[model samples]
Target: MDEGINSSTPAWLTEEFIEAILREDEKTQHLQVARADVQPAVAKGDNFGGLLHRVTAEIYYQNNGNNQEKSELRCIIVKSLPSDDWYREVLDQAGVFKREMRMYKVILPAMYKLLKEKLPGVTIPALTARTYTSSITNETLVLEDLRPLGYRMVDRRQQLDLEHCVVALRALAQFHALSVALNDRDPSLMDHFREGFYTPERRHILSPFLQPTLDTLASAVEKWPEYERFGDKIRQIAATSVDRIIDVVKPKNNSLCVLNHGDFWINNILFRYHPKNGKVLGAKFVDFQVSRYSSPALDLQYFIYTSAKEDVRDKSLRHLLQEYHASLTHTLQLLGCGKYAITFGELEQEMKERAFFGLITACTYLGAVLADPSEVVDLDSNFGEESRKNGGQSPMEKAYAGERFRKIFRKFLIHFENEGLL
Candidate 1:
């Protein structure tokens, strides 16, 4: 369909109008009209009675007037941009949504093909079409709506059980296997495919944004003497290590590269259940805006640190690492990429280096993200206000976030000390 309607144009236009503008020869009887409507879905903020945005739609399909078939219609709960400026800023910071849509058009098709061939039982969304328009600030992806299929990510407050973790780990391993196999068979093609993923512009934007947060976080920590002991160390680490975190951890070299869902947090994954018994059947990965080529360890570390609870992390860190390594090894063997992929020891080393990357990022940003509504900055205000109000987050929340990172930092330090990997 022609998505060239002007930004000022009224959202509602007849199907004939759209069809004529697009100049499609399809019969009017077969054309479907999709309209956008806003509905309450999920709250975007943590405050009591905070405002949130979600996309809801009424879909109409043209069929014989006499025939009564339940209209194929659905409502999807999308995480909407808070404002037009926010939408524009995200596109400007990341590239335009069109660029991402094009990238997904290529990679997702390949991933779907590989999954269908190698793992027939696994279910994922079938991509129908994608469209980007001025009215839709980001981009609207039209795919088989998987929500009605009963898929959802586990809640953030809850930890996935060992069985669920195993399933997720194995699925991720298989995904990495396909990536490695593709890269091995046609190195140039894979390289070409990844060329569209990372642009220098994005790296430049991320570095500066992270640096300011690092500075603000440093200033904020000094207020608490108990935590102030680590202030200089944290600042030094943030200043000197951010580049290494981005560069070494996210190197574009072919040998170390795989397709990573850059935002690997739990919310982006959806789980479905068996219809007959209402038992969990499988999970499907979503949200490809940050999908790109990077060390697979980047995703592995992100998932573990962000999704696992403190107790789970303390008890299962080593075992979880081992399980990931073993699953990856087996999947690589199945895909015949084991010959070219890294060994478990090598993977462990990469994990150690990359694990710190996530810790630093979490310390610098997570508290601001997760603080209670009463403790957060005004969404409409400038960064100056944001920094001053909560100093980016509540003192308690920031301390908790810092403590979490301190634990991770000590773990890495001990690993390096004992193994002499430093």
Candidate 2:
């Protein structure tokens, strides 16, 4: 452990705070901290798409007892709001930060408790990192650092293979199933989760960024020969893009709705592999900031469009969908929510009905997904006064203009056009 902490460490992350967090995480009140070291958990470009800043705290602690306590090291990840006021205010208005805090502090614990009581003896896969503590006032969350537990994030530049996709889908299915069961137990369980990235109410907050980005994308596409038609489609979509998103995300009557991981993609998912064979064993999700109570189809579409490999995205999509459906149904049955589970036909229909979500997500996020690590833009610099000074050509816009992003986006554009979504 470092004798001195990093200068950039948050004021709230004191030795006392670390002691309290360790107590909660270890479930042992006798743990007393000797010292702690705090440093950035991820590199600048690594978590560029994430809104919150992350730091890891290493605590060297001892058990308070007469039997000769020995110091041990424990690591935890702290997620906090960005220091930039402009970015903070935008996210504050969107209510993502508080919502995520609630997700960890309230929703997940209740869901897990319910499962433990109702399905005793059933083994549930760990669907997310454990939250040791959180503070709405502090705008911070202390979570179990999954890296030390062998959970690894798939590289942003690389897409998920079949094994990884299956693991992710299984975890997502269980997550959605548990959410549905909890909602059924108490219909208002997710009242606070009603609003997410695509709500009509948040259009004002999102349009300023969405419209211009689409304009840049459309302008780029216009220069390509056969791609000019997609540029026209992009222009039309950009004119009322928010409205289109709201339409797709709005709750419909008689649909299989579950809590949507509003930003489900490769970046938000982590997988643990089998020790000997290196096969994916399980998956965990992170960043609940944009989680919304919407159709499961939204998450499915978002995952397929943003994270799947080219072969899977283009050819093996249905196979992946089948895997997700099987997992969803199996989980639903296990949780006594079998009646709420939709058939493969119904799931397919729902995904097809909301196919526009795939296009909407692709237009906005696909560039970030395909961008090289070096090409990734810092989230704050892209949004703050820097972008205005760049004449709206922020580092993000330039990333979207990159040849790799354009070429990959072109594939989706063609697919969407063929599917009549464009």
Candidate 3:
């Protein structure tokens, strides 16, 4: 498929449409659009996890104000539904595209208003991208382009280090805390966000990816002498993963539930750094297509298992949890929901109760996370035409057969086996 902003670009992306949005954004009615350039934002290999087509539009407009003489350029990212019929149908059935639009339009704005009203002077860092506008009919989203603002996505193949992981955890904690506060104030705030990735209705969309990956993990583990004993356990989990994985989203304790960035991983987060010393400054999240209302543990474990380095996940996990809890408590205190804040012990209990989620992430997502650049196949190509023809193994399934994937899957299987979750 042509993944560029060329002749096939949407009809609504005309100069007149760009001019209207720009005029509203600048609050200048007289601004006139000279021209606009729209191009693909991410490179080929970087779009592995994305369900939407992404493009960046550099809008050149003449500002009618006194100080601005030349045309000022504004850059924004546009995300739209895939043009492929099969993929688009699956996303439509799952309702992820609409869920993301509502998240940016209604839910997140409410949370932002709550924060501003509750804490007038304190500046809480941003949790995600700033949405400019979105359309349910067009299946498009216009958002602030963070690239010009110095935020960049880390290489997916590289394991996230301690500093980046901490930043992500802190942001997630704030997100969870704020969602909890908003839900407490108005319970219906998340009524529309009821379905998650593992919802029964979504199985048709996910199983083609999930079942194959799990079976690949089972086949890969059976080859390892040390891990050979757990092959049956892995197969057992694969057999019932679709039905069992839903447990991750169900609220065992209703009081602790919050909104989850369901697809939280390296690809979905962007981080800003100091130019001089390369120190991490802040991070922002993106891609809420699979955002769900659930226990925060699912997001926490999904991120750590799919993104963090081995040492970080093995040794410093507790420290990371403490950091997340500290931020969560502080944010709750700021939002005047201190009484609802859970203790660290309670947070630990939450993780323990949802331990199966970590295993689910390992089987389904870890291969893509560790996939070599050469293994990056277009989602539609992999899951649509090629998938129907070649039922043997996908590039992603072959990624599971790699040694790195084997070692990581072994470790997770052992952990889950010890915990009796498998």
Candidate 4:
């Protein structure tokens, strides 16, 4: 039985569409972008995490602003809606595509401009991108690729090291700090973006992903006698955590809130390292599909818990937390709101409470994240045709059920529970 599932490239990345995005910038007005070779930014057919292809564009433009010579620009990356109809619909209905477009087109520029004007000494790294459509039918976002400059994700399967943590934590601090500055400058500055924050209704998107991961985790933890009860408890929570995760993003009085890059794991980040010595220099954040107005704790907890290598997390969590807060304090000070900096004490309290974000990140994400090549599930089958038929234990469930991921899940559960988080 063949299901006529429609999955292909977005119709809007054509040369004509590319030209219009170029027209958005005053600096590029002198040039016309006719056509370019677009290649998958990660790998062919790999949408990375969010059903969006990370793509790089090779563009040649004729300089007409000065009637000068034409030039080829190689500094751009583009993201487009998945060709898969189901992925498109899910992302669209959940406001994922819209939020990311708004991030690139609206929030990012506003935050950058505010940073430059309000805190001259502050440095914030941003992606230079043009967004075409928030419409799920033809969503497109063009971004500046930083890889040519020697920045990329640390090996995804490898545990992130102290250096990676230091760079990521500090950058996250600055990024969140800027959000505070944006809010302080004008309480309304973030109003537009806040509308895109995750909501309970968006839980529909998680349904396809959750239970299978829970089953996988449950099976993995079965060997650990200590985690025996948690296997069932995790299954229970994983089902309900969709709504719970959204609920956690809501308002809390007295706690300072900022726009969160809701998905703060390693793959969503890029790092620039020193050429001569291989020391990590800085980091840049990408992917704001799930970004929203919420306690900064959401991003902080998600990053440290899910992305840190086990040893790094066990040994350096305290140091990294301090580093994160130090950067936050200084950035807030530069924003002239030192008094409003969430104290390290307050931050810890918040992180403890929001510990589930990391767990959710682990269960919902790490299966696909940590899967071996031979183990990779064809998401199209489970999420597409199969879900439409009768969805139970899926290939995704089986793909993630490997012993390695199970142990990883068990470790996360044990950690959270030890902290009184579960």
Number of the predicted model whose lDDT against the real structure is largest: 2
Tell me how many clashing residue pairs each candidate has: 2, 0, 0, 4
Residue ranges of candidate 2 with Cα displaced over 4 Å: 1-8, 11-16, 23-30, 48-69, 134-138, 389-392
Lowest lDDT 10-residue stretch of candidate 4: 1-10
lDDT of 2 by residue, 10-114 (tens): 666677777776676677666766666677776566654233324344444444544334556676777878866677777788788888888888889988998
lDDT to native, each model: 0.53, 0.79, 0.77, 0.68
Candidate 2 similarity to native, TM-score: 0.91
lDDT of 2: 0.79
Global CA lDDT computed for model 4 = 0.68
| Residue 119, candidate 1: alpha-carbon lDDT | 61
lDDT of candidate model 3 versus the reference? 0.77
Task: Tell me each candidate's RMSD, in Å, in order.
Answer: 6.7, 2.6, 3.3, 4.9
Show the lowest summed lDDT stretch of 10 residues, model 2: 48-57
Give the runs in model 1 whose Cα sits over 4 Å from its true position: 1-37, 45-61, 64-69, 77-87, 96-99, 117-138, 159-161, 188-204, 223-225, 252-255, 273-280, 373-422
Model 1 per-residue lDDT at 393: 44
